[model samples]
Target: MITMVRNVSRWFKVNRFMGKCTVIGVLLAFVAVACLGQLASVQLLNGKSTAQAATASRTKTVTISAKRGKILDTNGAVLAQSVERYNVVADPELAQTFVPTDCKEKTAGNCQQIDGQPVGTTGAAAVARLLAPILGMDAKELGALLSGTGQYVVLKKEVTPEVMRSIDDLGLNGCVYGELSSERLYSNGTLMGALLGGVNDEGAGVAGIEQMQNAVLTGTDGYKKYERGGEGVEIPGTVTESKDAVDGSDVELTIDANVDWYVKKVLSDAKEQYKADWAIAVVQDVQNGQILALEDTDQYEAGSDDAKLNTSRAVSQTFEPGSIGKVFSMAGMLQSGAHQLTDQFTVPGTITKNGQTFKDATQHGDEHWTLAGILEQSSNVGMVMAGENFSNEQRYEFLSKFGIGQDGLGLPGESDGVLTSAASWDGRTQNTVLFGQGYATNALQVTNAIATIANKGVKQQQSIIKSVTDANGHTEDAKTGEPTRVIDEQVASQMMNAMESSAEHYSKFAGVDGYRVAAKSGTAEVAGSDGRLTSIISDWSGIIPADNPRFVVTVVMKDPQGSYGGLTSGPVFKQISEFLMQKYEVPASTPRTDAIAVTW
Candidate 1:
């Protein structure tokens, strides 16, 4: 019995071992077959596709746009500012499940129709309905827009934060919101429109002072990307990418909003009163050669679309300034040692030169007048005689110093009022230019000429921006100085004296009061195609508070109802001078020096 039991045990053990071996072999065979299949698939079907897919994933990159800089006035007032906006998006593929409607469903499957879009569906229609009202768009249109096969598509851009929140609560399937940035408001609207300009849809300034100083205004951008789990929870400190954005430098303008407002108001009112074709007004800080206010009323309104036109007539347009321009001729004579304020001109009220008659403002003609009296009366003949005394080269040099035909200034668009070469000044031309008959100049160039005298004969380049603000609320790059010299101090002094005298006399005549003023008015007939004066167009310009001048104001009246500077523009000038005097607390000009002596 013991021998039989041993034999059975041995057989049983052998059987068990064979069964285990069979199972192990079968497992090995299956693993080998699977390995072979995987290798073949990689070589024949997956290698190139995998490589191409990876390349495609890395090929196209996405970039977030940076926000532009802000523009401010001298007082740290926001002239141009940037605000955050949003773009709404939808995933049509996922949005098909929600129904678009006002009713809420008890379960995800039961979606309602909102504005005709199925909202409860996890499809594009629901996303469109939930977002359409918040975005102020037609849901039907939005759905159509989302019907695009793209994995992601934008529905609307520049959406405010409020709208973004409303969309987020809807929880529409596949709907996402994106963020964009742009400037929101202008402080004064169109007060300094021409100077501040505007940024593009991408927030880049394309014109005006903004474009001119982009380098200083544009800032850098920064970004952060972190690894997030499926539920939007951050994997602690798992920062994927990070970059910082630099905020743009703040730009401060020299323009004073109050002054600009008044200037524009006065000019615009004058435009209506004179029934003029156009009008321009300007005010400057004589101390630093900074332009306080520069405006043209006939061209634009504070919020009108037409105001955005590119023409900077204030710094671009120049014409014969008529009598107002007589001051420059007077300047030339004084600078050239050719004439004096005391020098007398023959009594003829008119000068017949080159078969053209130049008439003085007064028809009841004074018999003879001093150089000062000639300017006071705006005598064409007087200027002609004085201009003759100046050699052509001498005349050109004097005007040249005033920036006529010069290629420089504070703001852009400096028109070198046409200065005929000495050779080009024919005898007729010589007399014609004396009373501002032939030459043309921009308002800024003319303003600068007066500014030179105001700056004590030194013309500084005018700049609209005065300073920039840093991140820490500290100011930087402040333009805190005066312009370079363009004229002799004494010459400027004499010019100021003459202009003040004229202003005082005119103010007296016009019955305007409360300020010591000096001014000159011009009513030059705009040139016609026939090379003769046209009755249609007229202009006026002058300096104010003549002694120790605080402001240089220029008024241009085009095609006035009266068509004369003294009649149409003189009143406006006086009103503006008096208004500015009170507004700026400018002390009345009490000349400390006796009038400048003219040398022969």
Candidate 2:
């Protein structure tokens, strides 16, 4: 009985201890609930909990590409443009099991044979058979692609919209689809090709103005984000974000299409007649520096393998300018008051300095020549005699002022033709440079130098781009720099008069029937395959309507078989000058004259 009582007492004590622990546990549970409630309140005040935010909404975003800009001539003629194209893509795994809508009605084992294909064929075979004719693809080749396990595959690219429309009519969405894209199209084929440049497969500009101004021509692409439904369709009115694509701007070039086309024709003719390796030409407005025409025989067709070749020979190719460079030295001499148009010198047939003898292209006996006569006769000996009047430093300054050894008129790949400073000039180098040798210059630089004379000693920055029109229809004019006076107006006039004498007395081929022309012709020796000076670069540059000074045209033909600039490039300049006069309806300012004397 005592043992039973002690057991009951211990059991009571155990029960009491258990009750106290249970109460303590309830208090701890209450504290945890209160803490959790406070945390929940804080989170609710901030907006959303991390887990709830993650599961709150789902969105799918899609990118829309902006339309690439158009490259247009000053006349609004499209030079380079983006054309709408499509890419044929497929989900190969899905396409392998996809059934055409037309075949759906023939579920009784004949669906694979709907297109007269083999029976019991794979879904890919059926799809390929139906699409081959419309897509202009080989059925067997296409079937191999469709039967692949890849989820994404590009079947074809750059298909026309009409073909894409026809494919859409087939209702093969689950198997094949068309993605909208763009490809550049050149309307003129190879005309102004190098200047306009070409685009790559990614629809980005790769060369010429297309590359230089890509950022301005390439617009911003936008996107739209919206919630998707269970079936993968966008839920109605559940768009989370949206933005419109900005189309690329329109690049209006300074090139006049009509004049440029004519110049190209002339260049082509010169290339054919001269049988030369290459030809280049440039026409600039003296007052404004607008490049009316820039052409080359090495032009390439856009998007063609030929495009990989260098095409803008006018800006890219440099050569020893030969006699044409003499004009700048003459201008500099006159501007510096070192010489006058009336200064006379008895020029020997040849002059020697530093173990080098300088002679005119054509040998002649000693003759007396006035300043004008020196230029009219294109006497290298006379040029050398006058070159001694200026120090080496002064001569170098003159060349620099004439735009030699300067970065070209803002063109890609334009060479800053080689020019050794006066500090490095030797006796032979000095005399050679006096008549345009020992240094290199591109066709445009030569043209710019002559244009400076035509502009009455002012140098205007040359420009090929006229304006840029943005997507919003806003047009920005080209920032052609202001004209900087480089010489006295009187000196420029005297130089022009002497050039007129040259055209009338020596370069008769450069003169127009009714228009006064001031011009110079040059022939420089180019090494041939035999390592001898058997090749020549024929070149001519001039200003028309000498009294009024309207246009400056320069032409170059390299390695012509048997001709000089007066024979090959002169006619080209004349034809183009006549066209420019007629196109602009320019009136004859001064009657053509032939009274300029080459000798006393």
Candidate 3:
């Protein structure tokens, strides 16, 4: 019984050990299966992440530049425009190993021979020989560039479409590339050059209206997002996103191209005739305040390096206005009820006031003169004596009212001109101010200031831009400011009478055949460093068909060789006026009148 019991105990111990082993084996199998599941999950997640990364790497985004706007004149002629240009690029390595596939009857043997490498020099020479004449380049120079080690090199820039087409017909097979580009072209070279401004290679406006209205002239750039292939090439039918570019708006100016051409021609002739350092001209519609022409001799090409330095002198430069400014002083005195057009005063060759001496343009004896005669004589003493009736405050008020030192006309570099405040005036300055001295003004300011008289003392704001047209063909007209009454109609009419008489003094140059004309001529001395007269600013301002006064024309010349305003600028003003009258077909307002009295 004990043996049997021991055997049972041993058997029971063996069975329990086997049971434990079986449980441990099952646990081990479970752990292995859990570990394998976790590993499989990690590998699956990693595989998905890697695939996503690979897909992301194949995507590319391209930005497309918007088409720049056009700059058009009032007559819808293109003054400045963005034109399609190209850059010729060569894959030197590809060119070195090129094989011309276009085997025409005339080039088959040469093409086939180019495919062979008998000479140590690569096939670049063969390619250059075929491309040289069409590209306007020498074969040797082209061969050297094509034989270089670089993968890509620029062969030519700003090539014409015809040249590009010729290059394309050669079938160079990845050896040559024509990259698209643009250039700013001025249709009328050097006409309105400074006002039209310039653009860079990327078609960004850098100066003038182009710079001032760049945002309006430059459109929104678009973008394209596409998937690329493994070789970094665009994949077929894989564009993820695309947005078309919006072209810029077109800017139409108030300047008439035909008138501008004529004015420039007249000024050029005057500039040459007078042997002057600078010449400027401007024409305006006195009734509407529209500037018909603004020109200066200092002009430059659109794409030239000198463009940055060259600016419109009429807009930016200022000089002593000289006798041209007297029109305003006379208007002030008349409006102040201090003088009448027929009022008589004894005028002398010179007058001294507050230790400052004023004189007539030339030596003359004392004589009785009417207001009209005083102006016709352009007497500094007469102007000072007439202005003495009004206070300094009255003179400054008139100057400001006449548009002196007013806000800029919205040009890029417009000047407001100089007008001394009453508080800054000394005895000399106060007296000199009466005769249009001790202050300075630009051509535009002087032209507009005198225009107040021509417009019957209605000051109209000047403008350059006429309208803006968007890509969708919607045009928005540019607003010109309202006209303000600066003087009474009666006062203006009386001033006009005096101006007509004054203009008659220059009748030799200003008188138009069968037409009544009103004008004023001035010669202001340019002060030297020692406060003495060194140079002269000669100018003429006038109205055409003086009886009705449709247009106001002004001509200014600086430092002319031995000439005054009537001699240098008067002829230019007359020619411009005649051309304008004929061009606009303005009929005669009244019969021609005799010369008014200069001395009484």
Error of 3 at 92 (Å): 9.6
lDDT of 1 at 285: 72
CA lDDT of each prediction against the hidden true structure:
0.67, 0.81, 0.79
User: What TM-scores do the predictions have?
Assistant: 0.81, 0.85, 0.82
Over 1-600, each residue of candidate 3 has an lDDT whose tens digit, in order, gives: 999999999999999999999999999999999999887876775778877787787776766657789988888999877777778888787787775444467765444323343332347987787778788899899999998897668898888888898787666665786766656778887777777777766677777778767888898878888886433346889898998888899999888889989999989887888899889998887887777788888767655655645666767777777777788888888888887767777998999988878888889898788877888888888888887688999889988888777664666777777887988999888877776777877877777777888888888887778899999999999888888888898888777777888776788877777667777888888875577888788988888777888888888898887567887888898899889889989987676454445556
Worst 10 residues of 1 by lDDT: 299-308
Provide the lDDT at 221 for model 3. 78
Ranking under TM-score, best-scoring first? 2, 3, 1
TM-score of model 2 vs. true structure: 0.85
List the RMSD of every prediction in angstroms: 7.7, 8.6, 9.6
In candidate 1 the C-alpha lDDT for residue 508 amounts to 45
Backbone clashes for every candidate come to 44, 0, 0
- Please write out the lDDT profile of model 1 over residues 332-422, one tens digit for every residue: 7887778767786675877776676767666755466678777776778778777767877776676777777665444445466687877
lDDT tens digits, residues 378-419, model 2?
888899889777677778898898889897566667788899
Which residues of candidate 3, in runs, are more than 4 Å off?
1-44, 87-157, 163-179, 228-234, 528-532, 592-600
Candidate 2: misplaced stretches above 4 Å?
A: 1-60, 101-122, 147-151, 226-238, 592-600
